[model samples]
Target: MKQKMIDVSIHLFDKKGFTETSIQEIVDELGVTKGTFYYYFTNKQELLTTIHLNFIEFLLKKQEEILQDEAKDSREKLRAMIYMVLQSINERKKSARIFFREMRNLGPKYLEQNVEKRDQFRKNLQQLVEEGIHKGEFQEDLHADMVTRGILGMTNWSYYWYNPEGDVSAEELTDIYVEILLNGINKSD
Candidate 1:
Protein backbone atom coordinates (compact mmCIF):
# COMPACT_ATOMS: atom_id res chain seq x y z
CA MET A 1 0.00 0.00 0.00
CA LYS A 2 2.79 2.40 0.87
CA GLN A 3 4.63 1.58 -2.35
CA LYS A 4 1.39 1.98 -4.30
CA MET A 5 0.90 5.47 -2.94
CA ILE A 6 4.50 6.33 -3.74
CA ASP A 7 4.29 5.01 -7.30
CA VAL A 8 1.06 6.89 -7.94
CA SER A 9 2.38 10.02 -6.31
CA ILE A 10 5.54 9.88 -8.45
CA HIS A 11 3.40 9.75 -11.58
CA LEU A 12 1.26 12.63 -10.37
CA PHE A 13 4.22 14.67 -9.19
CA ASP A 14 5.96 14.11 -12.50
CA LYS A 15 2.94 14.97 -14.61
CA LYS A 16 1.93 17.85 -12.36
CA GLY A 17 4.40 19.82 -10.32
CA PHE A 18 4.65 18.98 -6.64
CA THR A 19 3.10 22.25 -5.51
CA GLU A 20 0.29 21.73 -7.98
CA THR A 21 -0.38 18.10 -6.99
CA SER A 22 -2.82 17.71 -4.15
CA ILE A 23 -3.42 14.89 -1.68
CA GLN A 24 -6.94 14.54 -3.06
CA GLU A 25 -5.57 14.02 -6.54
CA ILE A 26 -3.12 11.37 -5.38
CA VAL A 27 -5.80 9.56 -3.38
CA ASP A 28 -8.17 9.73 -6.32
CA GLU A 29 -5.54 8.36 -8.66
CA LEU A 30 -4.78 5.55 -6.26
CA GLY A 31 -8.50 4.98 -5.58
CA VAL A 32 -7.79 5.08 -1.88
CA THR A 33 -9.21 7.04 1.02
CA LYS A 34 -7.63 9.94 2.93
CA GLY A 35 -7.51 7.82 6.08
CA THR A 36 -5.37 5.28 4.26
CA PHE A 37 -2.89 7.97 3.22
CA TYR A 38 -2.81 9.39 6.72
CA TYR A 39 -2.23 5.92 8.13
CA TYR A 40 1.05 5.69 6.22
CA PHE A 41 2.19 9.28 5.81
CA THR A 42 1.60 12.21 8.12
CA ASN A 43 1.04 14.53 5.17
CA LYS A 44 1.86 15.21 1.56
CA GLN A 45 5.25 16.70 2.40
CA GLU A 46 6.18 13.58 4.31
CA LEU A 47 5.45 11.50 1.26
CA LEU A 48 7.53 13.79 -0.92
CA THR A 49 10.42 13.55 1.55
CA THR A 50 10.19 9.79 1.52
CA ILE A 51 10.33 9.79 -2.26
CA HIS A 52 13.37 12.07 -2.30
CA LEU A 53 15.23 10.04 0.31
CA ASN A 54 14.53 6.73 -1.39
CA PHE A 55 15.62 7.98 -4.79
CA ILE A 56 18.97 9.40 -3.63
CA GLU A 57 19.75 6.59 -1.23
CA PHE A 58 19.21 4.01 -3.93
CA LEU A 59 21.54 5.83 -6.32
CA LEU A 60 24.13 6.40 -3.61
CA LYS A 61 24.26 2.72 -2.75
CA LYS A 62 24.77 1.85 -6.39
CA GLN A 63 27.49 4.47 -6.73
CA GLU A 64 29.31 3.10 -3.67
CA GLU A 65 29.21 -0.43 -5.07
CA ILE A 66 30.66 0.72 -8.39
CA LEU A 67 33.41 2.59 -6.61
CA GLN A 68 34.30 -0.45 -4.49
CA ASP A 69 35.02 -2.77 -7.44
CA GLU A 70 38.85 -3.01 -7.51
CA ALA A 71 39.05 -4.95 -10.75
CA LYS A 72 37.85 -1.96 -12.76
CA ASP A 73 40.06 1.02 -13.49
CA SER A 74 39.00 4.57 -12.76
CA ARG A 75 37.79 4.97 -16.33
CA GLU A 76 35.64 1.85 -16.15
CA LYS A 77 34.24 2.96 -12.82
CA LEU A 78 33.35 6.32 -14.33
CA ARG A 79 31.67 4.70 -17.32
CA ALA A 80 29.74 2.32 -15.06
CA MET A 81 28.58 5.19 -12.85
CA ILE A 82 27.29 7.22 -15.78
CA TYR A 83 25.65 4.13 -17.25
CA MET A 84 23.98 3.38 -13.94
CA VAL A 85 22.54 6.88 -13.76
CA LEU A 86 21.30 6.78 -17.35
CA GLN A 87 19.81 3.33 -16.74
CA SER A 88 18.02 4.64 -13.67
CA ILE A 89 16.63 7.53 -15.67
CA ASN A 90 15.34 5.12 -18.25
CA GLU A 91 13.89 2.65 -15.73
CA ARG A 92 12.38 5.20 -13.36
CA LYS A 93 11.50 7.97 -15.74
CA LYS A 94 8.75 9.51 -13.68
CA SER A 95 10.57 9.09 -10.40
CA ALA A 96 13.71 10.62 -11.89
CA ARG A 97 11.72 13.59 -13.14
CA ILE A 98 10.13 14.09 -9.74
CA PHE A 99 13.43 13.56 -7.93
CA PHE A 100 15.16 16.30 -9.91
CA ARG A 101 12.25 18.72 -10.29
CA GLU A 102 10.35 18.60 -7.01
CA MET A 103 13.26 18.43 -4.58
CA ARG A 104 12.89 22.07 -3.63
CA ASN A 105 9.43 21.36 -2.27
CA LEU A 106 10.87 19.33 0.59
CA GLY A 107 10.94 20.86 4.06
CA PRO A 108 14.16 22.31 5.51
CA LYS A 109 15.34 19.17 7.26
CA TYR A 110 14.54 16.97 4.33
CA LEU A 111 16.13 19.39 1.92
CA GLU A 112 19.33 19.44 3.97
CA GLN A 113 19.45 15.66 4.17
CA ASN A 114 18.94 15.27 0.44
CA VAL A 115 21.54 17.91 -0.32
CA GLU A 116 24.09 16.07 1.85
CA LYS A 117 23.54 12.85 -0.02
CA ARG A 118 23.75 14.65 -3.36
CA ASP A 119 27.00 16.33 -2.37
CA GLN A 120 28.47 13.00 -1.34
CA PHE A 121 27.59 11.55 -4.72
CA ARG A 122 29.32 14.45 -6.43
CA LYS A 123 32.37 14.08 -4.21
CA ASN A 124 32.70 10.42 -5.10
CA LEU A 125 32.73 11.29 -8.77
CA GLN A 126 35.27 14.00 -8.16
CA GLN A 127 37.46 11.47 -6.42
CA LEU A 128 37.19 9.15 -9.40
CA VAL A 129 38.33 11.92 -11.73
CA GLU A 130 41.22 12.62 -9.40
CA GLU A 131 42.17 8.98 -9.41
CA GLY A 132 42.14 8.90 -13.18
CA ILE A 133 44.44 11.91 -13.34
CA HIS A 134 46.79 10.47 -10.71
CA LYS A 135 47.03 7.23 -12.68
CA GLY A 136 47.87 9.19 -15.86
CA GLU A 137 44.71 7.94 -17.56
CA PHE A 138 43.13 11.39 -17.69
CA GLN A 139 44.95 14.60 -18.49
CA GLU A 140 46.79 15.91 -15.49
CA ASP A 141 46.02 19.47 -16.56
CA LEU A 142 42.29 18.89 -16.14
CA HIS A 143 40.48 20.34 -13.15
CA ALA A 144 38.96 17.39 -11.28
CA ASP A 145 36.19 19.25 -9.51
CA MET A 146 35.10 21.24 -12.53
CA VAL A 147 35.33 18.19 -14.77
CA THR A 148 33.23 16.21 -12.33
CA ARG A 149 30.59 18.92 -12.30
CA GLY A 150 30.60 19.07 -16.09
CA ILE A 151 30.19 15.31 -16.36
CA LEU A 152 27.33 15.30 -13.89
CA GLY A 153 25.67 18.26 -15.58
CA MET A 154 25.76 16.55 -18.95
CA THR A 155 24.24 13.29 -17.63
CA ASN A 156 21.76 14.76 -15.15
CA TRP A 157 20.31 17.16 -17.72
CA SER A 158 19.20 14.11 -19.74
CA TYR A 159 16.35 13.59 -17.30
CA TYR A 160 14.66 16.63 -18.83
CA TRP A 161 14.95 15.69 -22.50
CA TYR A 162 15.95 12.03 -22.87
CA ASN A 163 13.22 9.78 -24.26
CA PRO A 164 13.63 6.12 -23.46
CA GLU A 165 11.67 5.22 -26.57
CA GLY A 166 13.61 7.58 -28.81
CA ASP A 167 16.01 6.53 -31.54
CA VAL A 168 18.99 7.00 -29.21
CA SER A 169 19.30 4.33 -26.55
CA ALA A 170 20.66 5.05 -23.06
CA GLU A 171 23.75 2.97 -23.75
CA GLU A 172 24.35 4.91 -26.94
CA LEU A 173 23.91 8.21 -25.18
CA THR A 174 26.31 7.13 -22.45
CA ASP A 175 28.86 6.21 -25.08
CA ILE A 176 28.51 9.62 -26.70
CA TYR A 177 28.82 11.36 -23.36
CA VAL A 178 31.77 9.27 -22.24
CA GLU A 179 33.46 9.82 -25.56
CA ILE A 180 33.02 13.54 -25.32
CA LEU A 181 34.34 13.48 -21.77
CA LEU A 182 37.37 11.33 -22.56
CA ASN A 183 38.09 12.70 -26.02
CA GLY A 184 37.37 16.26 -26.99
CA ILE A 185 35.01 16.80 -29.92
CA ASN A 186 37.50 19.17 -31.55
CA LYS A 187 39.41 18.04 -34.62
CA SER A 188 43.13 17.55 -34.06
CA ASP A 189 45.62 19.51 -36.10
Candidate 2:
Protein backbone atom coordinates (compact mmCIF):
# COMPACT_ATOMS: atom_id res chain seq x y z
CA MET A 1 0.00 0.00 0.00
CA LYS A 2 2.81 2.39 0.85
CA GLN A 3 4.63 1.60 -2.38
CA LYS A 4 1.39 1.98 -4.33
CA MET A 5 0.88 5.46 -2.94
CA ILE A 6 4.47 6.35 -3.76
CA ASP A 7 4.21 5.07 -7.32
CA VAL A 8 0.98 6.89 -7.97
CA SER A 9 2.26 10.02 -6.28
CA ILE A 10 5.37 9.96 -8.42
CA HIS A 11 3.28 9.84 -11.59
CA LEU A 12 1.02 12.63 -10.38
CA PHE A 13 3.91 14.69 -9.12
CA ASP A 14 5.74 14.29 -12.40
CA LYS A 15 2.71 15.40 -14.34
CA LYS A 16 1.47 18.01 -11.90
CA GLY A 17 4.07 19.93 -9.96
CA PHE A 18 4.35 19.08 -6.27
CA THR A 19 2.75 22.34 -5.14
CA GLU A 20 -0.08 21.74 -7.54
CA THR A 21 -0.83 18.18 -6.45
CA SER A 22 -3.30 17.83 -3.61
CA ILE A 23 -3.79 14.93 -1.21
CA GLN A 24 -7.32 14.57 -2.53
CA GLU A 25 -6.03 14.14 -6.06
CA ILE A 26 -3.55 11.47 -5.06
CA VAL A 27 -6.07 9.44 -3.05
CA ASP A 28 -8.73 9.88 -5.71
CA GLU A 29 -6.32 8.63 -8.34
CA LEU A 30 -5.75 5.54 -6.24
CA GLY A 31 -9.42 5.27 -5.28
CA VAL A 32 -8.43 5.33 -1.64
CA THR A 33 -9.53 7.54 1.22
CA LYS A 34 -7.52 10.38 2.73
CA GLY A 35 -7.39 8.35 5.92
CA THR A 36 -5.44 5.72 4.03
CA PHE A 37 -2.81 8.28 3.09
CA TYR A 38 -2.68 9.69 6.60
CA TYR A 39 -2.18 6.20 7.95
CA TYR A 40 1.15 5.93 6.10
CA PHE A 41 2.27 9.52 5.75
CA THR A 42 1.73 12.44 8.06
CA ASN A 43 1.15 14.78 5.16
CA LYS A 44 1.92 15.49 1.52
CA GLN A 45 5.29 17.02 2.31
CA GLU A 46 6.31 13.90 4.19
CA LEU A 47 5.36 11.86 1.16
CA LEU A 48 7.48 14.10 -1.05
CA THR A 49 10.36 13.80 1.37
CA THR A 50 10.07 10.02 1.33
CA ILE A 51 10.21 10.05 -2.46
CA HIS A 52 13.27 12.29 -2.44
CA LEU A 53 15.09 10.22 0.15
CA ASN A 54 14.34 6.93 -1.61
CA PHE A 55 15.53 8.22 -4.96
CA ILE A 56 18.83 9.61 -3.67
CA GLU A 57 19.44 6.67 -1.35
CA PHE A 58 18.89 4.21 -4.18
CA LEU A 59 21.31 6.09 -6.42
CA LEU A 60 23.89 6.34 -3.67
CA LYS A 61 23.77 2.60 -3.04
CA LYS A 62 24.17 1.83 -6.75
CA GLN A 63 27.06 4.30 -6.93
CA GLU A 64 28.79 2.71 -3.98
CA GLU A 65 28.47 -0.71 -5.60
CA ILE A 66 30.01 0.59 -8.83
CA LEU A 67 32.83 2.34 -7.02
CA GLN A 68 33.57 -0.75 -4.92
CA ASP A 69 34.22 -3.02 -7.87
CA GLU A 70 37.91 -3.89 -7.97
CA ALA A 71 38.35 -5.04 -11.57
CA LYS A 72 37.14 -1.86 -13.23
CA ASP A 73 39.38 1.14 -13.77
CA SER A 74 38.40 4.70 -13.05
CA ARG A 75 37.22 5.17 -16.61
CA GLU A 76 35.01 2.09 -16.41
CA LYS A 77 33.65 3.26 -13.09
CA LEU A 78 32.79 6.62 -14.60
CA ARG A 79 31.10 5.04 -17.59
CA ALA A 80 29.16 2.68 -15.34
CA MET A 81 27.98 5.56 -13.19
CA ILE A 82 26.74 7.48 -16.24
CA TYR A 83 25.00 4.39 -17.56
CA MET A 84 23.41 3.78 -14.17
CA VAL A 85 21.82 7.24 -14.19
CA LEU A 86 20.79 6.96 -17.83
CA GLN A 87 19.31 3.55 -17.22
CA SER A 88 17.36 4.97 -14.32
CA ILE A 89 15.93 7.53 -16.70
CA ASN A 90 14.80 4.67 -18.89
CA GLU A 91 13.47 2.46 -16.10
CA ARG A 92 12.19 5.04 -13.62
CA LYS A 93 11.41 8.02 -15.81
CA LYS A 94 8.64 9.47 -13.66
CA SER A 95 10.56 8.92 -10.47
CA ALA A 96 13.66 10.53 -11.95
CA ARG A 97 11.65 13.50 -13.16
CA ILE A 98 10.02 13.97 -9.76
CA PHE A 99 13.33 13.50 -7.98
CA PHE A 100 14.99 16.28 -9.93
CA ARG A 101 12.08 18.65 -10.36
CA GLU A 102 10.20 18.52 -7.05
CA MET A 103 13.15 18.42 -4.69
CA ARG A 104 12.83 22.08 -3.80
CA ASN A 105 9.38 21.41 -2.39
CA LEU A 106 10.84 19.48 0.51
CA GLY A 107 10.95 21.32 3.83
CA PRO A 108 14.14 22.28 5.64
CA LYS A 109 14.74 19.00 7.48
CA TYR A 110 14.17 16.82 4.45
CA LEU A 111 16.07 19.28 2.28
CA GLU A 112 19.10 19.00 4.52
CA GLN A 113 18.99 15.19 4.50
CA ASN A 114 18.75 14.93 0.72
CA VAL A 115 21.47 17.55 0.28
CA GLU A 116 23.93 15.45 2.24
CA LYS A 117 23.27 12.39 0.07
CA ARG A 118 23.56 14.56 -3.05
CA ASP A 119 26.87 15.93 -1.86
CA GLN A 120 28.16 12.45 -1.12
CA PHE A 121 27.26 11.36 -4.63
CA ARG A 122 29.08 14.37 -6.09
CA LYS A 123 32.11 13.77 -3.88
CA ASN A 124 32.27 10.17 -5.04
CA LEU A 125 32.42 11.38 -8.63
CA GLN A 126 35.09 13.91 -7.69
CA GLN A 127 37.17 11.20 -6.11
CA LEU A 128 36.79 9.11 -9.25
CA VAL A 129 38.06 12.05 -11.31
CA GLU A 130 40.97 12.44 -8.98
CA GLU A 131 41.73 8.73 -9.27
CA GLY A 132 41.63 8.95 -13.05
CA ILE A 133 44.04 11.85 -12.95
CA HIS A 134 46.34 10.01 -10.58
CA LYS A 135 46.43 7.02 -12.88
CA GLY A 136 47.08 9.22 -15.93
CA GLU A 137 43.82 8.14 -17.62
CA PHE A 138 42.51 11.70 -17.47
CA GLN A 139 44.43 14.91 -18.12
CA GLU A 140 46.46 15.91 -15.08
CA ASP A 141 46.05 19.64 -15.59
CA LEU A 142 42.27 19.57 -15.44
CA HIS A 143 40.55 20.55 -12.20
CA ALA A 144 39.17 17.29 -10.82
CA ASP A 145 36.28 18.95 -8.98
CA MET A 146 35.21 21.04 -11.96
CA VAL A 147 35.47 18.08 -14.30
CA THR A 148 33.40 16.03 -11.89
CA ARG A 149 30.74 18.73 -11.84
CA GLY A 150 30.81 18.87 -15.63
CA ILE A 151 30.26 15.14 -15.91
CA LEU A 152 27.41 15.24 -13.41
CA GLY A 153 25.87 18.35 -14.97
CA MET A 154 25.83 16.82 -18.43
CA THR A 155 24.36 13.51 -17.29
CA ASN A 156 21.89 14.92 -14.76
CA TRP A 157 20.44 17.37 -17.29
CA SER A 158 19.51 14.47 -19.57
CA TYR A 159 16.47 13.76 -17.40
CA TYR A 160 14.99 17.03 -18.65
CA TRP A 161 15.13 16.03 -22.35
CA TYR A 162 16.14 12.42 -22.88
CA ASN A 163 13.46 10.17 -24.35
CA PRO A 164 13.87 6.53 -23.47
CA GLU A 165 11.91 5.48 -26.54
CA GLY A 166 13.91 7.71 -28.85
CA ASP A 167 16.46 6.50 -31.40
CA VAL A 168 19.33 6.77 -28.95
CA SER A 169 19.83 3.98 -26.42
CA ALA A 170 21.11 4.58 -22.91
CA GLU A 171 24.31 2.69 -23.74
CA GLU A 172 24.86 4.86 -26.79
CA LEU A 173 24.27 8.06 -24.83
CA THR A 174 26.66 6.84 -22.17
CA ASP A 175 29.33 6.25 -24.79
CA ILE A 176 28.85 9.72 -26.24
CA TYR A 177 29.07 11.38 -22.81
CA VAL A 178 32.11 9.36 -21.72
CA GLU A 179 33.87 10.14 -24.99
CA ILE A 180 33.12 13.84 -24.72
CA LEU A 181 34.38 13.85 -21.15
CA LEU A 182 37.63 12.03 -21.91
CA ASN A 183 38.18 13.53 -25.36
CA GLY A 184 36.62 16.85 -26.15
CA ILE A 185 34.45 17.25 -29.27
CA ASN A 186 37.00 19.52 -31.02
CA LYS A 187 38.41 18.38 -34.35
CA SER A 188 42.17 17.86 -34.22
CA ASP A 189 43.19 19.12 -37.61
Candidate 3:
Protein backbone atom coordinates (compact mmCIF):
# COMPACT_ATOMS: atom_id res chain seq x y z
CA MET A 1 0.00 0.00 0.00
CA LYS A 2 2.83 2.37 0.83
CA GLN A 3 4.61 1.45 -2.37
CA LYS A 4 1.44 1.93 -4.35
CA MET A 5 1.01 5.46 -3.05
CA ILE A 6 4.65 6.22 -3.85
CA ASP A 7 4.43 4.78 -7.35
CA VAL A 8 1.24 6.68 -8.08
CA SER A 9 2.63 9.86 -6.57
CA ILE A 10 5.78 9.63 -8.65
CA HIS A 11 3.74 9.34 -11.83
CA LEU A 12 1.57 12.27 -10.77
CA PHE A 13 4.54 14.35 -9.61
CA ASP A 14 6.40 13.65 -12.79
CA LYS A 15 3.52 14.62 -15.02
CA LYS A 16 2.04 17.47 -12.97
CA GLY A 17 4.93 18.83 -10.87
CA PHE A 18 5.04 18.61 -7.08
CA THR A 19 3.57 21.97 -6.17
CA GLU A 20 0.79 21.47 -8.68
CA THR A 21 -0.07 18.01 -7.36
CA SER A 22 -2.47 17.66 -4.47
CA ILE A 23 -2.92 15.00 -1.79
CA GLN A 24 -6.55 14.79 -2.82
CA GLU A 25 -5.48 14.02 -6.38
CA ILE A 26 -3.16 11.28 -5.20
CA VAL A 27 -5.86 9.71 -3.08
CA ASP A 28 -8.29 10.02 -5.94
CA GLU A 29 -5.87 8.28 -8.26
CA LEU A 30 -5.41 5.52 -5.74
CA GLY A 31 -9.15 5.24 -5.27
CA VAL A 32 -8.66 5.42 -1.55
CA THR A 33 -9.71 7.69 1.25
CA LYS A 34 -7.42 10.38 2.59
CA GLY A 35 -7.23 8.36 5.80
CA THR A 36 -5.44 5.60 3.95
CA PHE A 37 -2.80 8.03 2.72
CA TYR A 38 -2.41 9.43 6.21
CA TYR A 39 -1.90 5.93 7.49
CA TYR A 40 1.01 5.33 5.13
CA PHE A 41 2.49 8.85 5.11
CA THR A 42 2.01 11.74 7.49
CA ASN A 43 1.31 14.15 4.66
CA LYS A 44 2.09 14.90 1.05
CA GLN A 45 5.40 16.48 1.99
CA GLU A 46 6.46 13.36 3.87
CA LEU A 47 5.54 11.28 0.87
CA LEU A 48 7.66 13.48 -1.37
CA THR A 49 10.56 13.17 1.00
CA THR A 50 10.16 9.42 0.99
CA ILE A 51 10.20 9.46 -2.78
CA HIS A 52 13.39 11.51 -2.86
CA LEU A 53 15.15 9.28 -0.36
CA ASN A 54 14.12 6.12 -2.14
CA PHE A 55 15.52 7.30 -5.45
CA ILE A 56 18.87 8.58 -4.20
CA GLU A 57 19.37 5.74 -1.77
CA PHE A 58 18.75 3.24 -4.53
CA LEU A 59 21.47 5.01 -6.53
CA LEU A 60 23.91 5.14 -3.63
CA LYS A 61 23.47 1.44 -2.93
CA LYS A 62 24.08 0.46 -6.54
CA GLN A 63 27.16 2.68 -6.71
CA GLU A 64 28.54 1.19 -3.53
CA GLU A 65 28.19 -2.28 -4.96
CA ILE A 66 29.98 -1.23 -8.14
CA LEU A 67 32.74 0.48 -6.20
CA GLN A 68 33.36 -2.56 -4.02
CA ASP A 69 34.09 -4.96 -6.83
CA GLU A 70 37.81 -5.77 -6.79
CA ALA A 71 38.31 -7.01 -10.35
CA LYS A 72 36.91 -4.03 -12.30
CA ASP A 73 39.65 -1.45 -11.66
CA SER A 74 38.95 2.28 -11.99
CA ARG A 75 38.04 2.46 -15.67
CA GLU A 76 35.63 -0.47 -15.64
CA LYS A 77 34.10 0.78 -12.44
CA LEU A 78 33.66 4.20 -13.99
CA ARG A 79 32.00 2.72 -17.06
CA ALA A 80 29.74 0.59 -14.91
CA MET A 81 28.83 3.56 -12.72
CA ILE A 82 27.93 5.80 -15.65
CA TYR A 83 26.06 2.96 -17.28
CA MET A 84 24.24 2.42 -14.01
CA VAL A 85 23.10 6.05 -13.87
CA LEU A 86 21.95 6.02 -17.47
CA GLN A 87 20.20 2.71 -16.99
CA SER A 88 18.42 4.01 -13.90
CA ILE A 89 17.19 6.99 -15.90
CA ASN A 90 16.06 4.68 -18.62
CA GLU A 91 14.44 2.18 -16.30
CA ARG A 92 12.91 4.54 -13.77
CA LYS A 93 12.17 7.54 -15.91
CA LYS A 94 9.23 8.77 -13.86
CA SER A 95 11.00 8.43 -10.53
CA ALA A 96 14.17 9.94 -11.95
CA ARG A 97 12.22 12.89 -13.24
CA ILE A 98 10.58 13.44 -9.90
CA PHE A 99 13.82 13.02 -7.99
CA PHE A 100 15.53 15.70 -10.05
CA ARG A 101 12.65 18.06 -10.75
CA GLU A 102 10.72 17.87 -7.48
CA MET A 103 13.56 18.22 -5.00
CA ARG A 104 12.83 21.90 -4.44
CA ASN A 105 9.45 21.00 -2.99
CA LEU A 106 10.91 19.19 0.00
CA GLY A 107 10.96 20.92 3.40
CA PRO A 108 14.18 22.17 4.95
CA LYS A 109 14.81 19.11 7.10
CA TYR A 110 14.04 16.76 4.26
CA LEU A 111 16.13 18.80 1.84
CA GLU A 112 19.18 18.68 4.09
CA GLN A 113 18.97 14.93 4.51
CA ASN A 114 18.63 14.43 0.78
CA VAL A 115 21.54 16.75 0.06
CA GLU A 116 23.79 14.80 2.45
CA LYS A 117 23.11 11.55 0.66
CA ARG A 118 23.65 13.28 -2.68
CA ASP A 119 26.94 14.76 -1.52
CA GLN A 120 28.13 11.37 -0.39
CA PHE A 121 27.51 9.99 -3.85
CA ARG A 122 29.53 12.83 -5.35
CA LYS A 123 32.38 12.29 -2.93
CA ASN A 124 32.47 8.59 -3.67
CA LEU A 125 32.81 9.32 -7.36
CA GLN A 126 35.60 11.78 -6.67
CA GLN A 127 37.37 9.07 -4.72
CA LEU A 128 37.07 6.83 -7.75
CA VAL A 129 38.55 9.54 -9.95
CA GLU A 130 41.41 9.93 -7.51
CA GLU A 131 41.92 6.18 -7.53
CA GLY A 132 42.13 6.24 -11.31
CA ILE A 133 44.78 8.95 -11.18
CA HIS A 134 46.79 7.16 -8.51
CA LYS A 135 46.89 4.00 -10.58
CA GLY A 136 47.77 5.82 -13.82
CA GLU A 137 44.40 4.95 -15.36
CA PHE A 138 43.56 8.64 -15.67
CA GLN A 139 45.63 11.79 -16.04
CA GLU A 140 47.93 12.77 -13.15
CA ASP A 141 47.05 16.48 -12.90
CA LEU A 142 43.28 16.06 -13.16
CA HIS A 143 41.22 17.92 -10.59
CA ALA A 144 39.21 14.96 -9.31
CA ASP A 145 36.47 17.08 -7.78
CA MET A 146 35.87 18.96 -11.00
CA VAL A 147 36.08 15.81 -13.08
CA THR A 148 33.56 14.15 -10.80
CA ARG A 149 31.16 17.07 -11.16
CA GLY A 150 31.57 17.14 -14.92
CA ILE A 151 30.87 13.43 -15.27
CA LEU A 152 27.84 13.77 -13.01
CA GLY A 153 26.59 16.87 -14.80
CA MET A 154 26.94 15.31 -18.21
CA THR A 155 25.20 12.05 -17.29
CA ASN A 156 22.58 13.20 -14.80
CA TRP A 157 21.12 15.78 -17.21
CA SER A 158 20.35 13.06 -19.71
CA TYR A 159 17.09 12.36 -17.89
CA TYR A 160 15.65 15.40 -19.71
CA TRP A 161 16.52 14.31 -23.24
CA TYR A 162 17.90 10.78 -23.49
CA ASN A 163 15.66 8.28 -25.32
CA PRO A 164 16.15 4.67 -24.36
CA GLU A 165 14.29 3.34 -27.35
CA GLY A 166 15.53 5.81 -29.92
CA ASP A 167 18.40 5.39 -32.37
CA VAL A 168 20.89 4.45 -29.67
CA SER A 169 20.61 1.84 -26.93
CA ALA A 170 21.65 2.63 -23.37
CA GLU A 171 24.81 0.56 -23.76
CA GLU A 172 25.70 2.38 -26.95
CA LEU A 173 25.04 5.75 -25.37
CA THR A 174 27.17 4.69 -22.40
CA ASP A 175 30.01 3.89 -24.77
CA ILE A 176 29.70 7.28 -26.40
CA TYR A 177 29.68 9.09 -23.06
CA VAL A 178 32.61 7.08 -21.70
CA GLU A 179 34.55 7.73 -24.87
CA ILE A 180 33.94 11.44 -24.63
CA LEU A 181 34.75 11.54 -20.92
CA LEU A 182 37.97 9.58 -21.24
CA ASN A 183 39.26 10.78 -24.58
CA GLY A 184 37.57 14.14 -25.08
CA ILE A 185 36.54 15.63 -28.43
CA ASN A 186 39.99 16.57 -29.71
CA LYS A 187 41.31 14.73 -32.74
CA SER A 188 44.35 12.61 -32.10
CA ASP A 189 47.49 12.91 -34.27
CA-RMSD of model 1: 1.2
lDDT of each: 0.89, 0.89, 0.92
- Candidate 2 residue lDDT tens string, 109-128: 67898889989999998998
41-130: candidate 3 lDDT, tens digit per residue: 877889999988998999999999999999999999999999999999779898888888888888886899999999999999999999
Q: Could you report the Cα RMSD, in angstroms, for every candidate shown?
A: 1.2, 1.2, 0.9
Q: Considering only N, C-alpha and C atoms within 3 Å, which residue pairs clash in candidate 2?
A: none
Off by over 4 Å in 1: none
Write the residue-wise lDDT of candidate 1 on 1-189 in tens digits.
999999889888888889999999989988888999999999888999889888888899999999999999998998999999989877877878888888888978678988999899999999999999999999999888999999999988988898869899988988998998888799999
Task: Compute each candidate's TM-score over C-alphas.
Answer: 0.95, 0.95, 0.97
lDDT of 1 at 114: 86
Winner of 2 and 3 under lDDT: 3
* Residue 135's lDDT in candidate 1: 96
Candidate 2: segments with Cα more than 4 A from true spot: none
